[model samples]
Target: MPPQSEVEPYAAIRRDARSGMSGRALERKYNVGRRTVVKAIASAWPQPRKKPPPRPSKLDPFKPVIDEILRKDLDAPRKQRNTVKRIFARLIDEHSMSDVS
Candidate 1:
């Protein structure tokens, strides 16, 4: 059989407990923690996981320079246009972007 979702177990735990199942029994039955059993009894749905705040990237400072290079390339012929390799080289040599790979 397919694995149950995060929700199905919580609903099952609540229903089983209502029929006079102990907290320890619920934990053993569901293969979940004591806190998980308590949480299930408290609420129908599980609390959403918290997300970490976004961090700045090394390329943040050089984004405008890259954009300008791309914009200028729009006027150039396809063969003469700035490639990724060329861009990286320009950043390192011209802009001194040695820190970023």
Candidate 2:
């Protein structure tokens, strides 16, 4: 394994690369791997990191829309009731919705 000091330089190189510096330029400046430069560039910048254990779907922004539609369907008279497929179709057609699953 490489020493921690070596790792620190790559982190710095990556930070510099994110600020409009090219990886090749970083490699020349830092004398590290082009691959290392690339890795550094990726690591240095702030990114939309994935949430751990992701937030529950119940709290999702579209939840209210889905709940309202479902409630309306469930409350309708049995003789003219909507099925799950029909409900989903309505959501797609009218609300431009989709299931993440």
Candidate 3:
């Protein structure tokens, strides 16, 4: 579902417009641009935000190594299993992961 923050303004703008509020007035009252006022008047719902494409991470190459460590940890004693600090230490000491912070 779309968030209430995005939906509420659209509903308010449309409602105000139907009650004879001017586009410029709606923009001022709602603190939005002329284009936003136009879109709100045209439709009851706002468009969903665009999702950014996934980018490569510094640890992308080391993911398989981390996964293998985690998989092995499933069989180890709970107290001896890898914590985040241990994982980071292992990445540095064993895998020579110097670039990632």
Candidate 4:
């Protein structure tokens, strides 16, 4: 396979071409292969379908509180930051959440 860096830029070039520009023009401007230009253009040309939102994790209910905790404790030492154990403990003690996972 080509290196990751080269592949990503080629994809971007392809996306740009599909939006309006010709493949030959894109290849000349971006120095990408013609095949790469074609592929990117084809993928982006079609209107993408909307995906449904993912289900929230058990921890998600506590996100607002978690954000508050993080904000308040931003200057605290790393060791004092919330751990998985602490999160589980808080979920059980405060929110009455079960070990769903």
What lDDT does candidate 2 reach at residue 54?
57
The model with the greatest lDDT is 1
Write candidate 3's Cα lDDT for 36-65 as tens digits: 999998888898899999999999999999
Minimum summed lDDT over a 10-residue window in model 1 is located at 92-101
What TM-score goes with each of the models? 0.82, 0.35, 0.62, 0.39
RMSD of each: 1.9, 10.2, 4.1, 10.1
Tens digits of per-residue lDDT for model 2, 1-101: 95565557767885686688876788888877777776666665434457789558733766787688778868788877777677667767877776643
The pairs that clash in candidate 3 are none
After superposition, candidate 4 runs with Cα above 4 Å error: 1-53
Q: How many clashing pairs does model 3 include? A: 0
Compare the candidates by TM-score and give the number of the best one.
1
Locate the minimum summed-lDDT window of 10 residues in model 4.
Answer: 40-49
The worst-scoring run of ten residues by lDDT in candidate 3 lies at 1-10
Candidate 3: residue 38 lDDT (0-100): 93
lDDT of each: 0.94, 0.70, 0.92, 0.72
